[model samples]
Target: MENHKLGRAPDFTNACIVMFGVNLGWVLLFLFAIYGLVAAVFICLIVNHWLNWVAVRRRQADQLYAGKTPG
Candidate 1:
């Protein structure tokens, strides 16, 4: 005989469901405020420069490979 009452899981198991009232924007602002604004901007600029450099390198590699490889 199979018992149906033992088959169900607990409702309060997920942590996200428990924090339903939290606003993520406020949390982000709190983090940014704890860190200085100038530092944040400098980090963003460095990341942007790195991403652009990588994209340029990838483009050059693609062009070089495209010319040599036969389809």
Candidate 2:
């Protein structure tokens, strides 16, 4: 019957749409995860640079107070 065929067609289309949506969601999730990891690495590098700067400044201050040039 025409009505039976129409109903079955929609069911198949809906199943395909759901499958496509799930695949797309997983792909987006993976992309975001990679972006987050890269951002974390960048933040770590910035923090390391800041810590080294602080250490260097402290050493310079110590040298100035001790009346000696920092080697």
Candidate 3:
């Protein structure tokens, strides 16, 4: 079993799967951002989503590891 501290995909396999989408989305969206305001919004959205995912994952894993069901 692996310890997923920081909500980083649970394991190497999962991490790769998750990062593939993240990287691909970033590349595509960066190209899509033609205007300055649009670019800022895109970047903020990307970063916010990533941070939320990390925090949520970490919390869930912590709950599960401590023998509590993740809600």
Candidate 4:
């Protein structure tokens, strides 16, 4: 029975190289997914900052001109 069980065990050692290849492919895919998420967040932050800056500048300009000006 022991011998039969041993024989039935998958010969993963023999197919180790293929398994390693598959594992590496998954690792690269996971890394790329993480990189994409981080990049998207970074882009969102930059755009948000730019919009805030523009709004502040516009307010400042309005305040500066609110005081009688005909030039």
Candidate 5:
């Protein structure tokens, strides 16, 4: 019962569904990459801040031991 003259046109719905799935996969990958970068930057910042704090405290302790005003 198929139409011989039209030859059964291609299925646009299936094509659209495939494209949507591909685009969704790419979007998820990009999101995960961005999240990883943000997490790395955040951890670096926290470590840098902690190291600076410890250095300042050590410097203050040295100054106090030398009987200075910690200027």
Candidate 6:
């Protein structure tokens, strides 16, 4: 895992999962203190969508690359 990367294939999903947890836990912890429950809920929803979307994009890219012949 030490050689794992963040945004590239193979390691991307694992990195995304780690990022999701950090954003949900630490970022929301501070947001809750500053903006309270309602605002934090909205922020959480937005963040969730963004993260999922990015993950989807990465996965699709991986599939595309896998099917392409080396040049």
- Misplaced by over 4 Å in model 2 are 1-35
Off by over 4 Å in 5: 1-35
My TM-score estimates for the predictions, one after another, are 0.49, 0.49, 0.49, 0.46, 0.50, 0.54
Better of 3 and 6 by lDDT: 6
Error of 6 at 17 (Å): 6.6
Q: How do the residues 1-71 of candidate 2 rate in per-residue lDDT, one tens digit apiece?
A: 65655333335878886997688567556755877656656655776798899999999999989999887
Cand. 5 Cα-lDDT: 0.77
Indicate the TM-score of model 3. 0.49
Winner on TM-score (4 vs 6) = 6
User: In candidate 3, which residue pairs clash?
Assistant: none
Can you write out model 4's per-residue Cα lDDT over 1-71, one digit (the tens) per residue?
55654436577785896887688567656756878667656655776798899988888788778974322
Across 8-68, the per-residue lDDT of candidate 1 in tens digits comes to 6667746664563255445445657988677556666776798899988888888788885
- Whole-model lDDT per candidate: 0.65, 0.75, 0.80, 0.70, 0.77, 0.83
lDDT of 3 at 57: 100
Candidate 4, residue 57: the lDDT equals 82
Candidate with top TM-score is 6
Residue 37 of model 5, lDDT score: 60
Residue pairs with clashing backbones, model 1: none
- TM-score of predicted structure 2: 0.49
* lDDT for predicted candidate 4 compared with the true structure: 0.70
Judge candidate 1 against the unseen true structure and give its global Cα lDDT, from 0 to 1.
Answer: 0.65
Give Cα distance to truth, residue 42, candidate 4, Å. Answer: 0.1
**Which candidate leads the pack in lDDT?**
6
Across 1-71, the per-residue lDDT of candidate 5 in tens digits comes to 46546567787998997997688567656756878667656655776798899999999999999999897
